[model samples]
Target: MHVSSHHQPLLVALSVAVAVFTAYVALDLAGRQRATAGAARWAWLGAAAVAMGGGIWSMHFIAMLALVTPVPVAYDLTITLVSLALPIVVTGGALALTARDGLAWGRLALGGLVMGGGIVLMHYVGMAAITMDGVVTYDPGLVALSALIAVAAATAALRLAGAIRTRAQRAIGAVTMGAAVIGMHFVGMAAATFTFHEGKAQRWFEASPVEAPVLALQVAGVTGIVLALALTSSALARRSAERKAREVEATLAEERQSSETLLRQSEERLRLAVQATGLGTWDWDMARDAILWSERTYALFGLAPGSAVDYTRFLQAVHPDDRAVVEAAVRTALAPEGDGRLEAEFRALQPDGAVRWLSTQGQTHFESGASATGERRPVRLLGTILDITARRLAEERLRASLQEKEMLLREVHHRVKNNMQAITAILQLEAAQVADEKAREGFAAVGQRIQAMARLHEQLYSAQDLRRIDLGSYFAELGQGLAALHVGQPVCIEAAVEPLVCDLDTAMPLGLIANELVTNSLKHAFPDGRSGTVRIRLFREGDDVVFEVSDDGVGSETGERAKGLGKRLIEALAQQVQAQLDINRAGGYRSLFRMPGTRFTAPDAAVAPTETVG
Candidate 1:
């Protein structure tokens, strides 16, 4: 059959129009394919294949109608119907393969081969259905070239279908793909050859055959319906995508609002906590040389709330004497070798010209150059300052009260010592005018006992701590005084006393007891040039103390046990201190007083004088 130029231009234009429309719908479906999943994704793929396949089938039939040959041509109904089904099957498979994520080159190539081979098969099969008293042959080289063009066009179409995104890009891709499809169809048509018999009777084609005009009308009707359905589906998919995007945006907006609410609540709670604890917060930006102080900080510094102050003002508020110390502490905290913690107590000069103590604690944060230099450049310093003025004032008042009490105690002890000394002087004066020798000795003994008590008050007045007396020193002095007063001949007085301390109540009783015992020893232990040693030993014994006064002399006579003032005084004093008295006369006269180590409470009144023990 010879080609006629009369209807060729119209056929080419119709083919191009159908191919372009098919490419447009295919690209639109491909764009929506990613936005769908599961059944929806397959639905879009099927829709794309139907739209493109129907258009391809329509274009093939329209182009065939344009063929003007010497003999009339008709298609076999069965083969043509089978040919129409080929594009739908093959395009569906190809679209499905390329629609998934991570499209592999091998899989895409295979899909191209399958789809191209199907198109070639469908075209040749439709041609084979032509029965017009003739046999058709294909130019092998032209057929091969056409198949190659189909494969190349299919591969490019699949790539564009998967890659195109924007509407303009999609349009461009559709036009390019349309040209490829049209080129493949025309090239395939060019490969066909037809031969007619000279005398064979014509066999009118059956099996659901139709004329070219009827086929063209059928193809146009089907293409129109398929494209309209595709446009409706694409519109619904876009609306669904927009609705989902709006829902996601609304969820994000709600989350942001919730986060802001929580932040405000957290800040409010922190403010309340700081206020309750009377903490003053501060932030110092070292690089900017600026300071931010909370309301409590201004109050702590004796300034109005919202008062502005910088590092220089802070230093000015510090007491002159403490300024250097505060500066040094801050420097140390910001030093590279430092631990970044600060704790300092310093006096601040308030606006009222009064000095107040402040306890400040803070931490330094290094934002940059922390590890690189001689000094760590602090990004910020955050901490609290507390007004410790009330505490300091209370402490000062307490210290003053303590000092005043100490002075009062010392005065009382001084007055007591003076009063006892006055009693001793009166006794000595009365002894000077005594008429009886025994009476004079008694007065002198009484005076010595008064002097012993005066010595205790004297120790209390002289010492820093007046609560307790050094018993060892008191006893040693007492022993020496008694020896000097009573002994006319040389009698060595030896003291073996350990370090012991006792309160005034215990000391007074123990001192009087020692005085009476020593006086008795000095008066009776030796007689008429019988020089001997009197030994006093005061020492700890377990949880008790033993005070022993012994003399190396003849023992007391039997009649001496009848009556004596010294013996009565010794027993009375021992009872007051809750001590047991033991008199030993085996080798020499020895008197031992054993008392509890603890301080004894004062008795209600003086005890009744006890019987003399010799």
Candidate 2:
């Protein structure tokens, strides 16, 4: 009846593999059925029962395969009961979960207790199914071990279910439960081990009746100690986890409160700042044409604090002339033609019968299409407005001041020009009285300088405004004056000039140099009163102003240094104006000057002047 060691390894290996596979299939089927949402709890329980039944059958078949010798008739019946009872206990455990009938706590407890009893019964049945030497034997130790395992499994499941709150915790609970069940099962199986005599035979009726009680007591003591420790540890672990969860929840709630408090304080500060600055806030409902304005905005409009305002009502407050412009600006702000910000300044009629200018500036904040519910409507117009009445008045005063100053400047320049004219006339009379050749020559130079100053007055008086004078018109007049003074009838000095502008600083020096050059050209070039054109061209080139005077009368092939007093006068005047002077005597007498226009900054010389003398 003894089994050889050689067969033992193969039998044990096969038994372990089959047992593991059976456990896997049962758990897998139960898990899949339980995961189906909206499915009846009883349906899943029934499926788990079928799966466990299959597992029990597999376990039995595997144990049977390990049999090298046949079992006794009584032992065979006991083993069958143990195998059947194992699946029944597991099925009852699952059923306990489904039979709540709205009395959850009580039903779960009853289910666990019943399942534990089934496990104990199965253990005793399995112990009774063992035979050696043609004798049947029962083990009390196995029954106690099975009872301990059953109680541990049921308690662990209940603790796990209660401990988990979230899905993640529930998943961990399931894994922990599986591990705990496996561990308990193995512990119980280990405790069930006993040595049997293969060489002896015993009578079934009186075989070891006293020994059974002694063994059962020892087995019960061991099981009781182990079960107490397991329960104590499970309770401690669950309590610790719950305490940690409560701490985490408190910390989160405190953080949320702090954030809300900070947001409220920030909003209050913003409100105060807007109020202090007299800034008016408004919101427009595009669909309803409704407008909501802050209290400060109502004050700005000189309306009562609780005035009824909408798009049409707001527009009515605007001045009639400015209404269309303000409306157009609002339309542009909501749907702008370009990316630039929208701004408009318009006069508004206040409730107190005062007309005040107001400037508004803002950009659009687009609405989300999904948020189309009451009070959750999106914000569109986000902008501010300021009462600019004072600023507009100040600007008007500044403009008036500027106009008065310009008029005074023109009068001053006009008086200065008249004084120079008087001085020139005096110098001309003094030159008429001089008799000495050298004295008269010196007097003529003095007279020319006085005349140069006099010419400025003449041009200033003739000009519409005295801020600036046209360089072209001034030069042409100088040329004509010189021709009339020196070159008479037949020579017929003609000026071909282009328009240019010069301020007072530039006009003075340039006028003197022009007079000297034109006089020299008339006296020297038109020797026999030759009819020819004298061209005076003034144009801008980069940052410089070019002034050139050319004549077509006399050929200037003779190379000689220009020693005439007028020629020296021209060079000195050109130098005084900070201009480059070039006198070319090729083909005809020509003089060119290039001057920096920075010193002659434009005042009111926007359009070039057009004047011709032919």
Candidate 3:
């Protein structure tokens, strides 16, 4: 009988297909070594080894099944099972060693020894399981060649396993690895030379050997299935890890949302506070030159609420006369040397032509981005605007009313002064016609006193502040009038007065006291035609003002001077002003009135005359 060695084209092709697919699956599974760690790593590693080992074993067995001879051939059950187990165990351990993250040449070589040794053992051992077959012999050279190919391919595949990145690279690597594995198998097959023993083939049917074609189909199908499962498991594991990561991210997002919610609530509360105070806020982004105004701020600027506005528009809306003031204030606030404060009171011109008095206060805030020139700068301008039109209008109206009252009061003072002057003129005319010297002197004294009162009214009517009087100026005029009345008298009136100011009430009593003292000095101080000086000195002593009038004439410790109507009037006037009165006759006739200084303003140097009547 004649037989051809098993080289069935279909079986060879089937083995090659299994080799290629298993190589791809192993390469794909290699990613798991990186994707997983701990116990999970070992699990994926086991799956990958199965695909690689099974493919090598299945390819060899299918090639064996392709050989046909006149003698029957069957495999020993124990040896065949052993051959399959050898590759799975050896490749698993080898792959685990190679999966140590980096490609050290020693580790790769060691891995190749384990993987190639197991594959060679599986081929030779499965060949040994053949029962009723002739002695299978191997060509030493070809056998060595097969082992070399297996080892080289295993080492190359290990390098590619870690390096595989994209689908195309993995596919290319798979094709190359598959070719080496298939080539190694075919080389091993070629080394085998079967020498049949005639008549021994009849014993094959007694053992009931399985059909070789059916066994080849089973090996190819099983190898394909195992490779598919390994790849599928790796993909599922990756998906599970990603899902857990997504869950963690979702949890973090929720916490972030809560924080943002609290911030928004705080902002809302601040906004409500501003609204309650009737303040309109503005935020300006200086970098963008953009202005964001609160609803109330828009209304304050006389613009339609919620409308878009910029600095240019804001300036246009300001009253023309006040525009420069507004610009200058902003410029000062933005200056590098200035404090970041802005204050401006300007009139805002509305679209409808109504004008509003607006007071704006702002603070500039600096930030890194506010750096227009890549350094620190003021980037934000935040402020408030208040409508002060009502307050301003009220102030104007009150001022006008005060002016009206002042004019009416001045008119009243003028009328009183005119009436007093008319009475003085009548008294003077009547006194001039009288023959009695004592009576004429009495009329002249009364008329002079009345004139003094009229002069006070004249001062009040001319004063800018009607409620206060300048005692220095008033006394100067009073002294001149009294001196004029006593023409050719031996007394020279000399006043050394400070620029003292006092209220109407205090000044009136002080004026009358001065009049009484001066009149007495002129009437009684210089007896026997003695020439002397009447000195009026007004100065401040501590918290009281002193009004002193002295004369270098007749001395008086008098209770005698106190008996007269002028003295009585002086005492009453001093008492009315809450002034302490002292009479000293040791040096000369001196009367001092000390009035509380609280009723007087500080002496004004500006209002003091360069020259005064003596």
* Whole-model lDDT, model 3: 0.83
Lowest summed lDDT window (length 10), candidate 1 = 605-614
RMSD of 2: 12.8
- Residue lDDT tens for model 1, 44-76: 888888887777777777787767676767777
Model 1 ranges off by over 4 Å: 1-280, 286-289, 295-313, 331-341, 347-359, 365-378, 386-398, 413-614
| TM-score (all chains, Cα) for each model | 0.52, 0.57, 0.58
* Of 1 and 2, the candidate ranking higher by lDDT: 1
RMSD (Å) of each candidate, 1 decimal: 10.6, 12.8, 11.1
Error of 1 at 21 (Å): 6.5
Model 1: lDDT equals 0.78
* Per-residue lDDT value at 253 in model 1: 90
lDDT of each: 0.78, 0.60, 0.83
Q: Which stretches of candidate 3 lie over 4 Å from their true place?
A: 1-262, 306-308, 366-377, 433-435, 557-560, 603-605, 609-614
Q: How many clashes does each candidate structure show, in the order listed?
A: 0, 0, 3
- The digit string of per-residue lDDT tens for model 3 on 1-614 reads 23347678888888878888888888888777757789888888888888788777888788778776666677787998899899889889888888887679999999988888888888889889877645777899999999999888888888888889788998899899989988988898888887766665345334335687888998788877777777887778778888988998898899889989999999999999988988999998988999999899987876777798899999999999999999999998887667889999999998889999999999987665545566557778899999999999999999999999999999999999999999999999999899999999889878888888888889999998898788778888888999998888878887777777887788777777777788888888887778888888888799988889888887776645556687778888888888898888865689988888877776546445323343
Per-residue C-alpha lDDT of model 2 across residues 1-614, encoded as one tens digit per residue: 42321123444444444334333333433443343435544454555454444343333333433334332322454575566657555654645464333336666666666655555555445545555445333345754665666666555454443343454654555555444444444444444433435645654532333332243334333433433343344345446656777899899889989989999999899999988888898877666766788888888789998888887888888999999899888766665333425699999898888998998887766554535452233346657888999999999999799768766766766787678667767777887797777786566656666676666766776677666676656665666666555534455444444455566777787777666655556656767656766666777779987877777767467733267676677788888878898878878888889988675555454544444454
